[model samples]
Target: MGPAERSVLVAWSTFTTTFTATRAVTHWIRDGHGPASGGITVGGRHFHHYNIGIALLSAVGAVALRGQERHRRHPVTAMAYGAANALIVDELMLLLDLKDVYWAKDGRTSVDAAVGLIGVGGIYLAAAPFWHRAARELASTAVHRPA
Candidate 1:
């Protein structure tokens, strides 16, 4: 995998871990309990842009990796990967109703987090091959692909 893919995976993993850990610890602060199945509420707010930061961070990582002496121009894949992540998260938000955050004793997190999860998962799936050399591989693929 390339640096871009690796960066995204690292970021996504970190992001999810951070969010999950925050939720577990701050469940009491957010509301009565942790994330729920059907959907969870966030400060009673309708919209939460969790992946915006993701996109920005991934974009930066991709750009930097491309400029580095060794790698080729696979930054676009990173961009595509990052874009996929953001797009998936946004789409998941709407589909899963991510506003609602709560978890039952059964370890059931809300469906609200589902979309974002899918998005995150998608990023990994895309980066599975070259997460370490993701930037280069993506660049290589970009050049080899017909269109």
Candidate 2:
């Protein structure tokens, strides 16, 4: 494939890896909690607030991609906003699952997690390389703009 397609693929893969990591942590914490407090306590990391950094990183990538795409400027912040919201949604899912409020009669809750991870993860993954390109473009434009 071409550069753009490759970039997109890389971004998608990065986001997928990020989501899977976050989900794994969430699942581990939910399963490990037995005292009704329901939180991760491994190697001194709570891991309860698990989505913040990844979401922020994705947002930055989103902005960078927007910068590359729109030399005229765009609401790249919206991408970040959406990612933040998705993070919250994932957190909610984790909480509900931990509370035992999420599950089918057949003990199926992983499906829900998988679906959200794919949907939300896809957003940031697509945004990452796009943002990186946008940021580069923006920098070039800025340098020329001053000249």
Candidate 3:
């Protein structure tokens, strides 16, 4: 409806898309449905998705904070931030324990957290308009009501 609303919608959509896509790709790789070797491995150390995620996030942050107006609202920056965040959060358990437990029982926490984040984001986006309206009404009433 307005610039703020449009921005929120675009941001939420981008984040959700990136998050879902990242999770799906991670699942595929974990299930051996992706690359033949699961993922890139070098020197007996397997590279995790979050590694690239962190890099992308850092790049996005750098660009966004470069004092360039055009770069701040760039779709690419938003997308990269969302995707990077998804990748990092998808491996929350691994990051915490410093071990691969993607298929282990505790790994479910990562999935839960990701899903919860998505759900909360969606709810906030959907309710933002109402929230704005309610805030305005409350302020108006407070100002107009008897003191």
> Which model scores highest in lDDT?
3
**Cα-based lDDT for every prediction:** 0.50, 0.53, 0.79
Clashing pairs in 2: 64-131, 64-135, 65-130, 65-131, 67-134, 68-134
Question: In model 2, where do residues sit more than 4 Å from their true spots?
Answer: 33-58, 65-89, 92-147
What TM-score against the true fold does each predicted structure earn?
Answer: 0.33, 0.36, 0.85
**Candidate 1 lDDT, 24-53, residue by residue in tens:** 444554454535532335687443334454
Q: Worst lDDT window (10 residues) for model 1?
A: 100-109
- Per-model tally of clashing residue pairs: 22, 6, 0
Candidate closest to the true structure, highest TM-score: 3
RMSD of 3: 2.1
User: In what order do the candidates fall by TM-score, top score first?
Assistant: 3, 2, 1
Per residue, candidate 2 scores C-alpha lDDT tens digits across 41-132 of 56875654435745665666666676565521233343344344435445554556565433334224444654666676577665777887
Q: After superposition, how far is residue 111 of candidate 2 from its true place, in Å?
A: 4.9
Better of 2 and 3 by TM-score: 3
Q: RMSD per prediction, one decimal?
A: 10.1, 12.0, 2.1
